[model samples]
Target: MRKLGLGLAAAALCAAVPVMAQETAPAFDAEAATQAYMATLSGAARAKSDAYFEGGYWLILWGAVVSIVTNLIFLRLGWSARLSAWAGRRTQRPFLRSLLWAAPYILIISLMTLPWSWYQEYYREHQYGLSNQSFGAWFSEGTMGLAISIVVMSLLIGGLLALVRRYRENWWGIGAAATLVFVAILLMVAPVSIAPLFNKYSPMEAGPLREQILSMARANTVPADNVYVVDQSRQTTRISANVSGLGPTIRISLNDNLLNQGTPAEVRAVMGHELGHYVLNHSFSLLLGFGVIILLAYLSVAKLVPVLLRKWGGRWGVTEVTDPAAVPAAFIVLAVYFMLATPFTNSLTRMHEQEADVFGLAAARAPDGFAKVAMKLSTYRKIEPSTWEEIIFFDHPSGHTRVSTAMKWKAENIGAADIE
Candidate 1:
């Protein structure tokens, strides 16, 4: 009688198992979910976004052409050679001479490019309702940027000129090494020294939000001690955040636009994505990857500069590749190479962004939030793109791609949200 009773109980338990499983299971339809997210944007908004993004594509090509033309004009008009001569006459000290030369050159470049700069950065932004900045405010920021450019260029151009004068034939090789070091230093300093020139950064207040961020950071081993908020709304209506810098200087900063405009879930999704950058060591990877790209660029310039000099050397008043006057010509070469490299560079960055998106979905468990934030990003980004367009231009996955990724994650997790 006891054995028979035990057997019946086991049978009853087995019968109930399928019912329990069915109750716990989540019902998620990835296709429907993704379609629903995409439906949130009106047809007009989508078209506007596409127009903005496509316009940027043309601007990039035009900008490159303008830069090359400007440099060539400076070379042909003997402006570069004249500057070199003026600097040489003024000071025997290399550093002083470079600074004096660089000041006028920097000013000239800024002046020459002002129309394009104003149109792209100020007028276009205002036209799109992306900027809240007044003309005075915009001009002030521009002046500051110009000053910063002068200072930075003075140092870099000064060093490169000195290296060119010293090394001549072997300068590119040595310069490549120096360039890598400079890159490292720049990365270390930019977050603290350079970024604050534009915006205020304050620690995020202690709260559930902070706690949540801390928990995520801890989970990912990101080594972030605090969350910082930057006043970005003063300039633009873009929401942004990053785990920037390297080594002990690494910082997690979100713009005020994010805090003001984002929902808690959206914030979490964004933070999770940013944290993935740290946890995955993307900064290091990008730095190293870009360093390699620069090395290749330098190598190509080494080979190309002399060939170009041989052709137009006397005409341009650049007798040799190492002539201080050759700076503009060298810049043109580098710019051309960089332009050609854009698609490859964007591909690499986009791949990493997609990885971070996956990481964010798993870490934040906020698929809807991710999709919504992606839609908001459609303010500036095209919601969809042709495969080749994305391959060549996008530095991140398209809005459609991002939303679909989240929905796919949701479909897999299904009822996991309810259970949690």
Candidate 2:
């Protein structure tokens, strides 16, 4: 009877072991976890990042002012008129004349804005320790970009000017449609043709990481057979990845910075976010949204340009909406429209990005990884911001928002096998 009692007690103790262990396990506190993740990015690093990001708010205003002033200078000085006249002397064809006018107009504007561009893009980037390129490399890339812009913008402007001449009153609607089509074509072609001009792209080497990314792509119905890595480290240390292009042109790519800086889980988290963009059809949705905005801009320009031309046409040497010289005036209105629309545009993009974050958290199942990467991004992005500042300026979620999201997800899924 003594031996039996002892055995029974031992069984009872064994049965209670798991229950006791479970009871003692601490519940995940999402808010605490979020604060802990944010704490990692303190001191001078955090201040620098905040300063850099905050400075961009002023840049947006200054950039628009510069652009508007530049266009005004061209018009007031009759530079645009002289250039258009020169192009007319060379060609009788309206489209050819427009193209000729565009080449010199773009070149002159670029030259005029070089100082501001250099300060904003080169000096400011270096000041913030965000750039990796030398002045020569940066200038070379800028020149290439200038040439591409001249060609593309010239073609687009020429087409629109032709429509303006033909359609007269209805040109705005048609021009808007044409611009959307041009944007779509650029989207399809840029990844293959234009991006390679700046960076070399290669297949991600065969390995567990590559296989894992491909596996995620497959799981998400992303039509990618392989992953490509871009040599973005040559330009900046920023980590990034994307599933770019439309339909048949779609490419899955990550910059070398991501590969170098990110752990496997971090890579997975980033890739999953990018894949979410594709799966959620963000590109198409954005196009549709922006198309509406573009239509409104064009409509406003249509009404405003003619009125301005009538009042200032003689002084500006621009007589008609169809005149190549009038392009600057039209774009001045466009610049202002877009500048004012910045908050709305940023919000639209931010909403999509947040949705992607949610999708990535589920797909990658790497909440901690996601949180860590958000901290890494704090090297450039402000990790926290006031609510209104985020709504107005940020196109991506603040790091604090991302980390908090990940913590919340982890809290809910604490008992999952893969979660720690």
Q: What is the lDDT of residue 331 in candidate 1?
A: 77
Error of 1 at 257 (Å): 1.3
Model 2 residue runs over 4 Å out of place are 1-26
Taken over the whole model, the C-alpha lDDT of each candidate is 0.83, 0.89
**For this target, which candidate reaches the highest TM-score against the unseen true structure?**
2
Q: Kindly list the per-residue Cα lDDT of model 1 for residues 270-338, writing each as its tens digit.
A: 998988887788988888778778878877777788887888878988776555677777778888888
Q: For candidate 2, lDDT tens digit of each residue in 5-56?
A: 5455655677855554544444678999999988888999999999999999
TM-score of each: 0.90, 0.93
Worst 10 residues of 1 by lDDT: 18-27
